[model samples]
Target: MEVKKKLLDLVRDKIRFKHYSYSTERTYIHWIKHYILFHHKKHPIEMGKIEIELYLTKLATNDRVAPTTQNQAFSALLFLYKEVLGLDISEWNIQALRAQERKHIPVVLTKEEVREVLQNIPSEYSLLVHLMYGCGLRMSEALNLRVKDIDFGFDKIYVWDSKSLKDRTIPLPQKLKAKLLEQVESVKLLHKQDLKDGYGNVFIPYALEKKYPRSKLEAKWQYLFPMKSISTDPRTKEKRRHHVMAQTLGRNIKVASQKANLNKRVTSHIFRHSYATHLLQAGIDLRSIQELLGHKSVETTMIYTHVVSEMNKAKVISPLDF
Candidate 1:
């Protein structure tokens, strides 16, 4: 209970500042728990650099954890000692965990294969995939889209508090406008149900809830892809509306991919990768693609250029060159 209470309070304060997500809070709590257990239940306050180093060493050697995971654990511990506990543990060092080089090429479906996959999905899942492919949205961003975010008048969709917690808008598809209208109607029904249950308030970041307390109940502010059921807020522990889980969408996709007889390991990301590659192949400028994808750097967009179909069409290839 001591370890749990200490961490829960620290994480709650961290969340109160609006500095991280519920997922980050959960991950930090987990690492702290593991760190404590590594010391035979000794409090980290009484612990020192040597104990932390031994734990990190175990994660690298005995656990053989992946490099990314090792880095995460390192970061969580760093935050705990310096930020949470106010301890100067900066002098402490551990052997860096070796990381496998991440492969650069994202899996991309061929142009025709994309159509085949699209043809096979059910209506709801198909729409989700379409937005991901058409707008270059992350699956979560597509699922989390609010009704007000769509701007048919301006032909743009606003993405708020995304990966970097930055707001950006990109053009809306004229093709999908009718589908958005139908989707909004469904969201209205879900909004009514939440109102009936006295749980109309949907989660919003920091001051937005105070600015518009009833906004969650309003049709305009409802999620474009509302979850099938209401959810309890992690911070307040009150039932509120949330968007459909990406896992639900993923399962639906998995079933459809099997039905479609797709041999390539299919995922929601495949659609996003196809979006970039297809746009590049169609001769859209890289800077334009960068904006659509919400990438901070042009470097991320450059990966799609590596796909075979992006090669110069005018180049003459000789069979003898190989």
Candidate 2:
């Protein structure tokens, strides 16, 4: 007996086939499910351009979602109709909700402030914050790091399948070398204990798992920041050691911020932003920063220039002088 899959299930299959990130898959599925429910569960194949516009307009005019959130929903729908349903929505007029341009600069911590925040965080997770700032890694990138990704001899951190499906290498901070090595020893000890307990596998990327069935147990494949306990793999249903949760790191940062008496809205990403801004302030060229940050465009890297203290010094004229 052949059982048919639901529309959302088919959408999930398509997203997986395309190798989209898990976060993107979740976001797309959420918006698609919302769109379906908003339209009385009408199959997306039956809904066209007009339905999308109405939903987006409601989000802007009634729900008042921010521009970026609205844009994300729009992208999800676009993928659904074009990629999943094979419908041509390009010809249909899409009156998307216009979001106001973001004018505020990103919040960045000074060197002293970063030091204070790190001091306040628990020692177990402080290294993660250092990696975020030092290597310009996003929270996911830092947490997803494997044993082989950190090349201590070469002083490089290999970032894999980052945003935009791009892989990049960042300079490993010399100051962090000893601490990272210690951390690696800890992971090795944990892995050895797990293997002794008859569970030593780590989750590999979907395609890689299929290609190299034995790679999951390889020492180099273990997460650098493995979680404290083993868990069942959601996809494979086998108990494996997963990396530390981003939320745990985020919560620690919030606590550290309060303890440090910082006045800014701080998050894990703030470290990455501060990294770029600090590099720009140090006179690094925009092109080089772009490559280090894995930004596809130099323009994206240029945003840090606006927030660097050097720019403020050059651009702001004091009223007292006038």
Candidate 3:
């Protein structure tokens, strides 16, 4: 007789088979576990729409979860039922508590503020922050950059498999060109040393790893910002150097912000917001900014317009100026 797999293991298998990001898999698994435990360890197979609705309602009311949090939980459970358990929830009416839509503008730093924050951070992390603000890159996109992605001749950085799993190129900052080249040399030396120690493997995407078996050992395939220490790959268990962790960058930015005396909340993403807003202030059009930011919809990019509008209002000129 064959042994059946655990439900969460089955979920993990399906998630990986679909090529979902590890973060997404972790988040989905977390919510699924919470859902199961919330119902006193009841099997999800025995639960249906009503059980899901009750769980979601508890998240909203008793747990005081935000609407988006509740929705994420719902999505996780939905995936569990439809994909893992092979259940049809199409016609089920889920009367769960809904979170109110928020309209708060994103926090953006002024040019001077951005510079101040950069000045306070270490040189290495400052470069990362610079890329985020200068190129409007997400933290992950910046960290995941490979040596081959930087094109000096074209004067652009190729951002592959970004937030929406789409690719785009942004102009490299002219000021950072020399620094980037220097960093490349440093990476080459590090890679050489790593290879000398017989531990130079880097993680490649699944499809590419299959297509180019030896690419992982190539210099061009090496991470631009490799982690200081090697780690075990969660899936393969092979020891390799991954990209710098996003949390490290986040913490560095937080420390820099505090040191810079910034009263506003600062995070890695604030650089991206500042990038978009500064471009709009410089008379760049929304469509172009949208493309630079790799936003799927111009509508999603319109939020920066609000930020700029608020800035403009602060500088209002009265008729007394005449």
Candidate with best TM-score: 3
Q: Which stretches of candidate 2 lie over 4 Å from their true place?
A: 1-5, 309-322
TM-score for every candidate vs. truth? 0.87, 0.92, 0.94
The residue-level lDDT of candidate 1 at 126 comes to 75
Q: Which pairs of residues have clashing backbones in candidate 3?
A: none
Ranking by lDDT: 3, 2, 1
Q: Compute the lDDT for candidate 3.
A: 0.88
Distance from true location, Cα of 322 in model 1, Å: 11
For model 2, residues 20-42, the per-residue Cα lDDT tens digits are 77788889989988888899777
lDDT of each: 0.79, 0.87, 0.88
Compare the candidates by lDDT and give the number of the best one. 3
